[model samples]
Target: MVKGKLHSIETFGSVDGPGIRTVFFMQGCPARCLYCHNPDSWKMSDGRETDIDELLHRAKRGMPYYGNNGGVTFSGGEPMLQGEFLIEAMKRFKEVGINTAIDTSGTYYDKNTRGVIEQADLLLLDIKHTDSEKFTELTACKQDPLFKVIEDIKEFNKPIWIRQVIVPGINDSKEYIESLNEFIKDFKTVENIELLGYHKMAIDKYKKLGMEYKLDGVPEMGKEVMEELRALVRFPGKEMKKAC
Candidate 1:
């Protein structure tokens, strides 16, 4: 049986998707986002190898709380890195009436990854930075693959929630937010856009892991300011709508 490297599991996650979800943080990622909280999930070998049946069984434990909207979310260290496994895993979940979602950095894609995309019921994709240079500086990866995968998403007509981390001094500006609104204007399938407040909560995680906390001195995004910036995003149907 094909197995996936799992970083962790959250039994009742509220923020990742529509409702209460069983979130699977798959291990391994190509992007090195400077403010990432789960830095330990970056290496696949660091994870516990788990098969699909076991994952489904564990996820089902949260079924009663899932209600109509809640289900499973395949998160990261970029879940797309384990594309083949995800393809099979998502299939198994859907066969049992569970709604499946993928929360990805949009950094990786290929044939198998495309299968993962095609099978997913919803997607939470991060648009790290719209500009190529800034995107590379933020993620240490090119923005090309994400763009390519987005084209496929368009073809598949997948429902997606676009997310961006609102780092205080980095990408927290009216100009940038407006640009973001313009960027996704053509994505009719966009269910909503989320501007997540960047926080320093990951510093301790870095300290424990002995990894350098790249955004060490940056302050967490304030709610008031985040609200102000969120108002600037003007996608047609989802203007300022929060991820449900």
Candidate 2:
């Protein structure tokens, strides 16, 4: 039985994915994104270890809600870190006719990870920055896996929602936005593009965890800026048209 290290679970999370999602935040991430909200999930040691059977039992309770456009979402630190567990859990969800989605930073990509993601109905792939240099600086991870993740999603013909976090001064340049638009052009599976505004709500978490807050003086991202980005990168595919 494959067991996953779980950070937490959100019963009715509205923002992570489509519908009223039951988000399972899996533990462990290779990327150290400067603005990461769930820093607690970064460490593999911090979460409770559990198996697919236990997770399936919890997911089944939301069956009625699942019928009303709600289903299971696997979020992270980076859910790809627990690929085997996710594969098992998603298999169970598929058996019961539940929708499955994954919110990922795409920091880890391998043959096994590819296999697991092939079962996903929707993928919320986070593109921290369009520029490779800026992405490395922000997340301390390479860009190859991120690109590969996108390519793999396209190969599987799965639906994907490209999520970009608009951090002030980090990746808000007009040049970068154009670059992002071009970068996503090759992907046919991208159904929608979402520009998430930066927030300082996670600063307190950094302080409590005794970690340095990297974006301390940074201002929150505005709605106007988000709209600007959305207009710039009009992704190709069938739009879900539902608000997160």
Candidate 3:
């Protein structure tokens, strides 16, 4: 049986994907983003181990809510870290006519990862920072893998929602948004760009976990600023909708 280390599962999460959905918070992540809310999930062995069958059973309980617009979303700790488990779970969901989505950092792309992602109906690809040097400094991870994943997504012809967390001084720059707009212009599969407002909601989580909260002093991004950043993306006016 294929199993994965899991941090936890949210039965009725509205933010991770379309409509109402069940979000599987899989364990382990390669990126060390300074503002990561779920620092507990970064450790590969920190969570419980579970198999696909059990997860599917839990998913079925929410079938009534899933209906046509909602389904399952595999979030992280980077779901791609457990590619084998994710692939099996995704296949099972599809067999049952579930709409599947993945919220990933795209920090661990490879042949195996690509294969699993190709099966997803939608992808919430997180772009940490557009500037490679700043991104490396912030997350201590390479952007190459993320770019590669985007390239593969283009080839696979899958719908993708590009998500970016707007850290005040880290990634919320006009230049970075302009660069991203140019970088993604050739990829016709991009359906939306979500500008996530930065918040310190995870500071308490970091404190409880005994990890230093680096952005403790940083205030959450205001609505006006978020709107400004959204304009920079230049996504069609009709597609610019706030995600809560």
Give the alpha carbon lDDT tens digit for every residue of 1-244 in model 3: 8878999999988998888899999999999999898999999989899998899998988889987779999998999888888888999999998889999897887657888878899999898877788789888898898888887788899888888888887767778777777666776777778889998899888878888988878888889988987876865333434657
What C-alpha lDDT, on a 0 to 100 scale, does residue 132 get in candidate 3? 84
What is the lDDT, from 0 to 100, of the residue 149 in candidate 2?
86
Candidate 3 lDDT for residue 215: 84
* TM-scores for candidates 1 onward, in order: 0.95, 0.93, 0.93
**Model 1: per-residue Cα lDDT over 41-140, one tens digit each:** 9988999989999999988899899999899999989999999999999989989889999998978876787888899999899999988899999999
Displacement of residue 15 (Cα, Å) in model 1 is: 0.7
Q: Model 3 reaches what TM-score against the true structure? A: 0.93
lDDT for each residue of candidate 2 in 121-202, tens digit (9 for 90 to 100): 8999999877788889999998889888887888898888888888888877677777777778778877678888899999
Please give the distance, in angstroms, between residue 218's alpha carbon in candidate 2 and its true position after superposition.
1.0
What is the C-alpha local distance difference test score of each model?
Answer: 0.89, 0.85, 0.85
How many clashes would you count in candidate 1?
A: 0
